[model samples]
Target chain A: MATTANSTKKFRHRVMSAALAAGVALAAPALAYADGRVVVFSPPSTDNYIAAWQSGLKKKAADLGYEASFIETTRDQSEQDAAVQQELAAGADTAGYIWWPFINAAGTNSLRSLSRTGKPVIFANQYPLEGTESLWTAYAGIDDFANAKTAAEMLLKACDESSTVKCDKGLIVTFPAGFSAGADRAKSFRETVDGKLEVLQEQPAGFTSQDGYKVGSQIIPPVKDDVTWVYTQNDSLASGIVQALTEVGKTPGKDVLVIGGTCHGDTSDLTSGHVIGTEVQGAYLEGWYTMQTLHRYLKTGVVKDGKVYAEATPDAPPSDEGDISRYNFIPSPPVGNSKEAVEGFRLWGWTMDELCNY
Target chain B: MSRREIFMDVMFRTGLMILVYVGFALFIPSYYSVRGVAALLDGAVVIGLTGLGIGVTMLAAEFDLSVGSLAALIGVVTLNFINGAEVGMVTAIVLGVVIAGVFGAAQGLVIAITGINSLVFTIGSLIGLRGLALFMSGENTVNIPVQRLEETDFLSASVLGIFSIPSLVMIGAFVLVAAFLRYTVWGKEVLAIGGGRTEARAAGVSIKRAMVVAFAISGALAGLAGAISCVKLGSATPLGFDTLLLSAVTACLIGGIALEGGRGTVTGIFVGLLTLRFLVGGVSGLGAPFWMQNLAVGSLLIVVIVAQLSVRQLKSRHDAPALPVH
Candidate 1:
């Protein structure tokens, strides 16, 4: 009787241990699934470039085994603050936040609100004002000054190639007056080409093809014969300048060289030689690095606040800033006038087809 | 109204338009050139259409703030139908305009049923429709397929060296709307309703039907403008027509359209649009800074309103019976 009772007790103990093992196996996958969540606070997804950037970030985050979500904000600051509050209330174990502030000054309150949550907030695209670094973990975006400087350099090269059109006088069809990015880009272009080139006129056209066409039509007819090169803020504006120049009997790439400051809109202009060249702002790289940084912060619990260079050519880096920056500076290279330059351009592992999905 | 008063009123409104053109022509020599005039007309076509739409609503004692959003929405929708749904350009445009008109009629029905102010109702739609536009286009500019663009190329084609198909369309719309407002019994009922809703209702006018028809017409015209602009641009963006609302309202007011409804002419609205476009194009051509252009527009709006008020006050006093005592 004693032997039988001992055997029964051993059998019950074995059953309980197997059941415990099975439960542990099931909970392991669930734990892995709930590893960490990354929340991205972005502006309205209306812009093609912004949409592309978000898509890249989401793709990278998913690849890195992190659950990523996005919250969109309008131009209103109060609404952004409310969204942040709502996100914080509903989220748990939030690894970090990727923030793209729409307007710099109005975005400070949003930054302050996010800072109180003790989660690292990564500011992308628009750089905030100085002394606001405490509110964000780091900044990641195209250096507009560098971008404009690159455009100036390209314009100078184009002028040097031609003998008839001296690089002395040029026209700048600018973005709106007070916008920080436009202001910085215009200022940088002027400063870089101050002694080398004489800017004939700088007109502040709002950032649209229509506005560009309007301003270009008004200014191009009068200045067409005089100006050597036209520097537009983006390809959309560059296309407008081409149209206006055509209307005035001037060929864009022939009579006057047109430099699209950024590569956006249809790339057919680049292939057809309407736009001489443009700078690749590395939007995809900016997004990929943003996600990678978030994953690193989650794993290490240490934020490395420094520039990241994800460029096409490993050898050619931005000459202005050497590899010794504390903040991440993604590499933005200039594409030449040839179709090969556009087709051959690559960032990290992604091709132009993947980068410019818009 | 005496013939002299009528003539003076016509001169007062249209005279301002003529003076603006002459002033720009004199000061800015390039403003008189063919290219300059063509550019002005090209810029005015879209806004002029929107202004006419708003003018129609104003004539019926209603305001359609959703015209701008409707324009953007319709443009995006038309492009989507062509690109995403693979529909023919003509079919897509007609479908887009019809859908916009239906939406407008629905809003009118809501206003009629609930007795809500048209302004408030359209303001809600303005926000909602903009949101809907963004959603429909996924917040990007929907590009029309290259093959489909040839069908709509007439929008950009110059017909008479100075006029494009878009400009002709604007003119046709203006003439059609003017004739409709002047000849039809429904048009007269709309005017009467605007002048005095209580009296119109007492006289057995179909207020609900007239309001719905007026709003539908406005929506269809706005949609047509959007479709034309989309073809011209070769793409349709969700926020492309953001500035249309303020500009259209300013054009209506400057054209001597009564804000309280019951008064305005299509010809006057067209002239007002031309004046505004000339000011914008002329100032930019003359090297005026961006801020100055905005200031000029704002100042012009305020000056017109204040001057009209002053004139009305003077006329009322002049018409008052003479005092009995010294």
Candidate 2:
């Protein structure tokens, strides 16, 4: 009987050891990477550009082994504030947050709330306003001032290209007030071309083709003969201007060169020479950079106190052992009005269709 | 009302529009000619049609807060029907309008039966309909294909060098609405309800039917405006009508349409739209800042409202029976 009890004890000990090993094997991957969630706070995907940005972020999040959970508001600051509170309540497992405010300048309180969480907060698409640099870990998007300046420089070349018209007098059909980028771009362009080109009028329209059509149709008739160039801040707006000019019995390129500052919807105008050119400020590329910057912050936990424009292709992970700069802006390069402009144009390993068309 | 009275009323409204228009023309460059007036009207088409639709609802002592959403929804639905469903453009547009009419009628019936406040109920509809528009559009601008662009090119083409098809449609709609209110029994019922809701019910008005008719007309007109604009603009965003409702409401107020329902005319609404159009376009054309436009429009609106109220008080005082004692 003593010998039988000893054998049973040995067998039980072995079973326990095997069970312990199996449990350790099962939990190894989980222990190695927690796969926490990255919360994305943003406005409703009300347009393709925003949708593309969301998609780009989603892809980057997945590749980094983190799931992206989005909290959408209806472009309302109050709604965004409420969303932030709810998100903060259950945010312990969050890797970080990528926030896009409804109004960039109006929602500083919510931005402060994100900063208080002690997790990296990355701003997407829109750049944070001045004096709020401490509120965000990093910002990744287009620099509107640089973009408009680039277009203004390119526009100088088109001044002598108009065959029958002097491209000296121009009109700027810009974005409505309260939108910071429109103001930034318009102000930058005006400052750049102060004496070189005469800005006859600056009307605040919307960021859609319909707004362009309505405003262009209304504003172009009286000054049709006087204006030899038109700078619509959006490509969609440029398309509408093309139609508007044609409707009013004026040939778009021959009468007025429509310079699309930002390449967006309807690139056909570029191929057809209706729009002289537009700078590539790819929303997708911007989104990809945003996620990369956020991930770099999560990995390194260091944010340098300065700005860097990402002029390279397919933006790299932060340099110097993954230290993300404060503002990571994508390049905005001007392309001419030809098939060669969009057919094979690449901004940081992103094709025109993959970047601008988004 | 007698023909002479109708003629006098028409003449008075026309004379008022002319005087205000000429006054604006004097200060606004390029606005003294026929082309300028046409362009102003053309730009005002969206607000004008929306104002007319809202004006109809106001005439019944009720108002619609959902017309803007309805416009966007119908535009999206129509574009999808044409492009996605591959239907004829005209057929798609008409179907969209009919659907809008049915939707409005349903809302009207619900409101009438439940005795719900029009403002509160229509605000709910506004949110729901805008959601629907966003869903149908996939959060993108529903662009009509290039092949179809030519089909609607004529809409933007100048008609007689003074008007586009859109402006003509707007004018025709105003005329039709004016005739309906002046001649049709349902229109009079609407006016009567606006004038005195209790009195109209006591006089055996089919309140439900009248509400349905009013909402249906408003919905149809609003849909037509959206269809025309979508075709003209080559696309429609779900948020295309973002500022349209406010502009239309401003038009109604400027046109002296009483919010409590009963006392406004289609002519007054048109003139109101014209005033707003000329003010905004004129200022912008002359390179005045947006704040200046706001100030000018605000001052004009204040002056007009004050003048109308003073006239109304005087007329009421004059029409009062001479009482020997209080």
Candidate 3:
């Protein structure tokens, strides 16, 4: 009788273990299906503007009842590919992906890898290369040509009003060479102001206020008397230019007209009248709309093609296939020296304070 | 080691520095002005400090490639302590320096125990420490309020109407390091070890202890440099000092420091730092295009290294013993 009872107890234990294992196995698909996370492949997390974009993306994702996560990549293209591969291997049920392609041409491998995941991939910040659109669902960012044209026009207008400085000669302090946006902006600015202005010097001041100050200090002193206007690709560089000019006893607005091409941070220069004008690059709105477009595609089973969105708003509903191109351009409005202009600025429900303050 | 050799070395380096200054003054008129000199010296402070640290390690026959990363790490830590943790400025600076020294000692201990190549070990530390900095700072630029920087802004202060506090600090560091190497028994032992580890061991020197101390001093100086830069910039950025390691190494090489170890002068290093800063400043002032500026620096460095190598070969031939007449 004791042997029989022991056998029965052993049998009961095996039965319970088998049942538990089978239950977990049955629920595995449900757990996998429930994950609605959107992964953002971004540049190094240290960049202030990129951080702001991610923050906006996360905020928008949360509001839409979806979870958002980020995978940091070094500027190296292979590193970006590796990061995407590692994420995919984890087997999470990802809703979609946002790719910020660290280097535009070098990022083709990353795009191809994400395409294998069979999820919609939205190219953010950096524009994708040609012939790689099959892998990318849509491109959402500022139009580099239009943005540069706007900045050039602003500088021309400033030059026209100033009586003391000649409108014919100017200097451009731009981002480092080989950067797509920098190259585009410089080309467009030169073309737009071709006959109107003669570019005395085009220097790469980098994207930091310190570099800008150093470069400006070195270049401005010799031409302090002749140069009419100084155009910087960003506000940090513009602020640096102002500091360099001020150190030499030259008033920025009075001695030389300064324009910050992109207003991303520290609008004090704009507000204080150091810079004559700037434009809203809408970094936060870019991140927000990338996710929004991805969410729409996932919900509606339709891809919006060739439609250019303005001010982070989708102009048309999702289409199956139409005359829409692959590119979607976000409208970036210009901001002037007036306090009212700055205060009244809004891009996709975000005020300047929210977008500019990282 | 001969007096004539020593004199030639000093004169050669000093003469080169003077030539560079005169050249810049001729090409870029503004480079000779008081403000231009001030700006050049100001720019040299951080690189000079880093070069000094590299000089120390090179003197001890060890290579610390992580000096730049260590400086960046300490900068981040010091700023975070003062701004984020609300630690007092003095306490934060002291703590940052101490931590850096300890980190150096730990690296020394690893090299001492494992007997690994100092270059490889420190290269690993270089990569690891930069990642650590990024992690600690959340990969963000930490901005300190301008008011928070005022008390510790001695690095940027003008001292005697001619020199800034940072220039003085660099000078003071050179003096102290020179004195220590000349007067201290431990310093003598470090030189001996660099001359030959086997010979040093036979001569009753504590190789491990001396190396650890050298590394500690190097780390402390790097930390101080980072602190100065933090105060000067009023912000600590993750990649702010990325150019530091290359600049320091270039300064050392240009200063005539023997890469194989054990031979260099603080004075030579100082002049080298000044020469490099002037060259960069002068290039920019000359309105050279951005690409041209980079090409010029690269070409100059290559020429210097090749010239130094040619000199070494010639010196070796001169020192070679005469063959016995048949």
Candidate 4:
């Protein structure tokens, strides 16, 4: 039995050598690891708010002497996982993954699978799920909670102007779904708006413009005049609400102020008339920083813990009590008054320099 | 053509269209206007183009569930190739059309060789083709560059002042197909085969060849419609044809194209498309919430179908001979 075991071990070693020989046979000229080809897996397409980030990342890749190609997976979690598998199958060695979780639950499992390859995994719009970051580099575009706080502040101001009391009666519409950022936004918005204001309605909009319209329209029918503002999670839903109000012959801003996030081009139309105020998600910067961090991690094993790579929560500070809540929280500049806000938004994102460096 | 036959056919289809349009108008206030009619026509042209192929295939007692997915695949593939090549818009469109024909031919081969039940086969084909498209496109939305396509004027511009060029093209295609199916020997064979394959075989018809030709033609037409739509949108999305299946099926059904096969018309399908368009336009123009419009369109389809079937049943009852006092 001992002799047989030894022989089996020898046979396995021989097979391993043969496989190595076959691999070398297939490729005589193995490109050096520094061939400077970085494969990027973007969960959302270049068309979404993330394009700014992609553009920045491209510039950064060029600076780093890395040619990069991005593949979008339409933010479908299962499909995104499949996409990662496809990329690995297509020979994307030394690849970096930048993901914006479509739903919160999907982020952990998907990232964990990718991290199993021991490649550098980067997060653009989401946080690391507990143990997942130990295997990968995690970075964010902006502080989701801070942006939500900014959005809430903007809404409060709008509500105060129309309200009879010092604090306005506000209705916050959000999704019940998971996603650290989405949940953070809703939680922060409630925390900021609560007690100071009369909460009129806080129904779910289901992360879609159609839902925003449906829920917004439903709420509009009942309120006589006390509802001072309508706050939504995104611009699409904001547009839906605005459309509903316009139908009822009531001017949005004049009757009640509306506020939402996503400083997209579409939101500009709504903000132009002071119909709504928005907190832009800095996608470009997020992309640039994500790639920058990964490149740094690849070159140097050191992960920059103190550096404010992206936004962190102010309410819940880091577990290490000595550490400050450090984050690269780039604030979305206010569009000023209703008249000036609509003139045109820059669609705030990372500059070319930031992207290429990352 | 006999005057009575032409009159009856036109009246039957046209009447069905008007009734559906009017019924929707009752629900949506804006549906009664000229703009609503125009909207219906625009939608009809887009959906009807594909529905025409479906209608034809239905008349032959077969189905092509892959039509929608195939259209999306062709649109995305053509746009990617065109954009990648930096080719002229005209050349791109031509290439798109040719590629579409090739895709159709591939599907035709499967049906011809396998002799599988088309309904089951097409369902599988639809899922597979859509998966292939999604994979190929990397799940990205491709903007159509509508302005560039619009410059062609002949194909993209509104013609005769009110009708869209694409819509006109769709109508022309319908007439051509209708004529070919009704007047040509091949057309007679298709009708005969659909009516009764056993009878057609007895008459010495080449069943496999005819069925293959019908499926191929259906697929090619769907591809053409998808390409044109992509050009209009200035972008192609994997979800571009998401509505294609439901709309095609609904339009075909409403056009009096029996799912059981051996009965339907190009004109009826065209009218059905128009009716759906008006229904959508009217509700949208009236400014209903986004989801409500979808709900209205869906429920309205069921109502319209039931109403038409009911009316046909009533007419049959009326035509029955009176019973004697036995």
Candidate 5:
């Protein structure tokens, strides 16, 4: 009687295991049928930043039942184009939407072309010039020119008031001043400084800190005493400028004020008083918004919100904000030294937990 | 002076001096002051030293493409030893030198034992060594703290009233190497071996030993060059000396060092390096478009190579028998 009972129990266990396996097999196809993917394209050199951004995007993508991957280009237009083409080709098979940090104008066109294929494309942290509006569904990034103006004003304020020195008449080591973004920063800076500042020297330091250091080390030592500011085109350049200045025995804030745009993680030196300020980009918020927009677009297939769609002109500019979004001219709040710099980080809209997602 | 000899010598010497002076003169006006020239010189020293290593190797009809990556590895090794540590700079430098020597010996062994072409072998090593550099740095930039060197008064201080210390070092290294090649017996043996390997061996020279020594010196010097550059830049990147191989090789070539080997002076190499320096300074100083520099270098290289090739062709033609008039 005992042997018969044991045999029946063993038979029941096998039946339950088989039923559970069958249930999973039946549901697997439905999971595979879900159309959810987010594509991020960034410069290969900015892999560190993209990696950090994607880690955050992945968490949200997972919670929302979506997929995300990133492609990195080495700052070359052709290389960037190759990355985009590869992603677009793959996206045709398994893509819900596309996201990109356009390396330049041509890259924007590539993104626009991809968007025409009925896929939502998000231009993250860079906007196209006029007449390039058919590019993407939405744009997410801080205004670069505003960041430049804020940097210029803060630099002028940091200079010695009694010295009769104009911060504008200092060396401007910037990126190659060819693109709309770099050109905008250069123009805004020149306008803010007015005639009081003379650009003694302006050279392209590329966008990397190493490039900035190479340009800065050569320009700083002999001119540091007379130069009131070592203006960089961006935050990474500013970090390099500071490192170069420090190497030459001139403390950054004490010897020469450093100012630039783009507050990537490298700007942590500002919190330690090693650098002055930079325009911080809200990377996390941008990533989250991208996923949210992509999800909605894939589900509803709508391009614009209700009333905005009615008022939209085909020729409307590709601005991150509309004419109604509070102040069409956004301010890149100054990331001053100390607590002010930390406050600048608040715009990222990421809790400490989310920020650590990278 | 004999007419034929004087013409040939004048052509050579004039070419050499003009190249050197023009190299410096072009930068003087644009830099606006002597101090700017001095700073430019500092950066040039690092390249110039590596050129010396390449110059010596080229003299022996052999090449070592691994020197570039080897330089970076040696630099990071030096930095790791010295960074925020109680170890003295001299001790760290010595360790770097020893390690570089050992690495060079291994390369020398491969070339000597396998009979494989140095070009292919070193190219493989170059890729492998670059990977090692990236792995060591965890693919991050390593910023060397200059404070210790600065505190010891060893780091380069103010640019001289007329020239910078690094530039001065470059000039001194060029002179020292020039003197060594011209005045030393070992230099003659190098020339003999390069001119004809069989002849050099028959003449009682230890060809294998000489080759090994040359490789060792080349590697050690390259290592030193990378370290100096790290000190100057205050940081080291995994990209390392790869960007500099072109400049170093070009300097050696334009300096009148023959690709066939055993045919150049260190002074000629100096002229070549200066020419490159001028190219960089002129384009950057004149605020010309950056792409123009590449064009300028390309044009200058073409002009030099054509001139040299033409001279060789003319000499061969002169040596040939004239056809008798029928």
Candidate 6:
């Protein structure tokens, strides 16, 4: 009797395993599908900011409906077109496209493709190239020029206040050639600091702390005496600048003022007082604004050609009284020092954890 | 080869390197300083190791275009393995280097058996492996925890205000690679195969084995280069390693390494790397734009290669017998 019972149990287990395998094989295609209403295309997650962006997006997306979907790709214009084409071929349920391109395709040629979609498309991370604003419904991201201007203000302030070092001589380390944000920031910083600050050197580097460290080690030794203030376009480079300065027996906050123009990853430099200051530019808030703007437009059915800057807070309703045609950027708020970045500093009612890091 | 011929080439390459060094030092006062010299070597560390590795693979008349992708992947994966997988740093680094070697050997085997062009095969690996790295890392920078930052310092910290662990490792790699290629039977076979595969095969050299070993060495060195860089930065991002491929190719060209095959010594590659680094360092030191630095390196590479070809042609004409008409 025991042998018969064991055989029956073994036969049932085999049947269950086979059934489970079949179910998974069938479900894979359904998992890949992104369609019917709002479609967001983003790069695959590599940093906490990306993860935070997705979370912020989903929280907003959940209120709208299940029709909101997300697709992951690191593609340019043609590839994005192909993806949209595939969606249409498979009985297109997508309402509109929210494209965060890996590269800036902000030109007349790309504008033609976005217009061809015949639906509202929101461009994020890059402002629409000037004179071609009519093609996209809305643009949303940090304003690179404004953020750099803020950085310039912060650096100039540091120079005015410091009794230890002359802020008159400065250098800027920016992202490698062809990166849009880096170019925009460098131009603005140089322009704002003209005559007021004697900008010594401006060089392009890869967007990593290692790149910062390498460039700083090679370039700083030559200009160490003259260069009292350094501005790295992003926070990662700022952290690396600290490492490089310390290695060469220089005190960063004391001897050289560091202005990490835009915040991104690793704020430990700020808390440790290695980096003197950086502006608040959070990915989470950027994501929230993109969805909120797109959602409002889908409801309002308007495209007024201009810029609509997202200000105040994350929970606040997007400024969609009419339609935003061109740009919507996140505000860049400056945090003075480590103490302020860690203590009671607030932007739009959110702490650094929520406004910057999250 | 005559003793004179060997001496002529060695002296010529060394002399050119010194000329460039002196020129840079004269223009940029900092180039004369110990710290400045160390900084120049610091710039060369990653590319120097990558260049030397590819220089070895070139001995067997094979190209490993996958070194850049392999370096980036191995570096990031090593750190990730240690931090995320909770393994000891040494074990993680060793595993990364070993995996890189095995991965390269697999590519070498495919090239040997199929007799496909190595450039094409390695390019495929280049794209595929980079994709794999991005997939693994989620397209982001992987950094060591803040507390671990101090641990990374000893690698870059100046020893007596001169040589750090990284610079030492780079020099050590050049010495070992030069010694290995000069002394070992397998190394001689690699050179022979590069000179003429059919002739080498007739002489009982195993082309397949030689290619495998050269690539394995190249891949292992690239891995170690990546490992050393990670130790210093305490972080890794998977893009930027492609720059090494261009730098390595240019270094080999400047070093008098023939793409057609068997020529040049590891010392020649070192000199080439030094010349390249000094040109770049001096340009940056002068506050010249970045494009000028690239232009200088390109000009140096072209000049050296053209000069080497001219020398070869002159020697061939000199050795030719009198014409029948004469």
Q: What C-alpha lDDT do the candidate models reach, one value each?
A: 0.73, 0.75, 0.74, 0.62, 0.61, 0.72
Model 1: DockQ vs. true structure: 0.01
Interface RMSD values for all candidates: 23.5, 22.8, 23.2, 21.9, 21.6, 23.3
- 2 or 4, which is superior by lDDT? 2
Which residue pairs show backbone clashes in model 5?
A44-A73, A168-A197, A168-A198, A169-A197, A169-A198, B255-B268
- Evaluate residue B271 in candidate 1 and report its C-alpha lDDT on the 0 to 100 scale: 76
Alpha carbon lDDT of residue A85, candidate 6?
27
**Residue pairs in clash, model 3:** A306-A324, A306-A325
Clashes of each: 8, 2, 2, 21, 6, 4
Candidate 4 or 6, higher TM-score? 6
lDDT (Cα, tens digit) per residue for candidate 2, span A1-358 = 9999999999999998987786666545334444667778876665677777777887877787776666664443433544564445333367888988755654555666678788888887666766677778888888888888888887777776666667788799886544567778888999998988999888867778888999998999898878888888989988888999998887877777888988888689898988889988777666667888888888888878878887555434334236888887878788889898788687666677666774
Name model 4 segments beyond 4 Å from true.
Answer: A1-358, B1-13, B19-40, B144-156, B311-326
- Among all candidates shown, the one with the greatest lDDT: 2
Docking class of 3: incorrect
Docking class of 2: incorrect
Q: Please compute and give the TM-score of the first chain of candidate 6 against the native first chain.
A: 0.83
Model 1 over residues A1-358: C-alpha lDDT tens digits? 9999999999999998986786666445435545567778765556667667877787778887776666664433333443554444333466788887554543554566577788878777765556567778767677788889999999888888976566667899886543456767888999988889888988878656787899999998887778778999888788888889889998778778899898767677778887888877656667766776666655556544555554556334222212222355566678887878878777665555455435
Candidate 4: C-alpha lDDT: 0.62
lDDT of 2 by residue, B1-326 (tens): 34664455446545655766665555443465555655666667777888998898998889889998898889889888888888877787789889988988888888889999989999999999988887887655676764455576576567886788888989998999999998999888888888888999999988888888788888887788777666565556575576677778878877778888887788878878877776655544432333565677788778777876786688789889999985
What does candidate 3's lDDT look like per residue over A1-358, in tens digits? 9999999999999998986686666545335435777878876656777777877688778877777767764443333443554455345577888888654644554566577788888888756655566778877777877888999999999888877666767799987543557767888999999988889998876777897899999999888777778889988899999999998888888788899988867888888888999988767776776677677667776665566755333234233223323577667778898888888876656677776655
Off by over 4 Å in 1: A1-358, B1-6, B27-30, B146-152
Instruction: In angstroms, give how far residue B60 of model 2 lies from its true place.
Output: 12
Question: Which digits, one per residue and each the tens of the lDDT, describe model 1 over residues B50-87?
Answer: 89988988988899999988998898899888888888
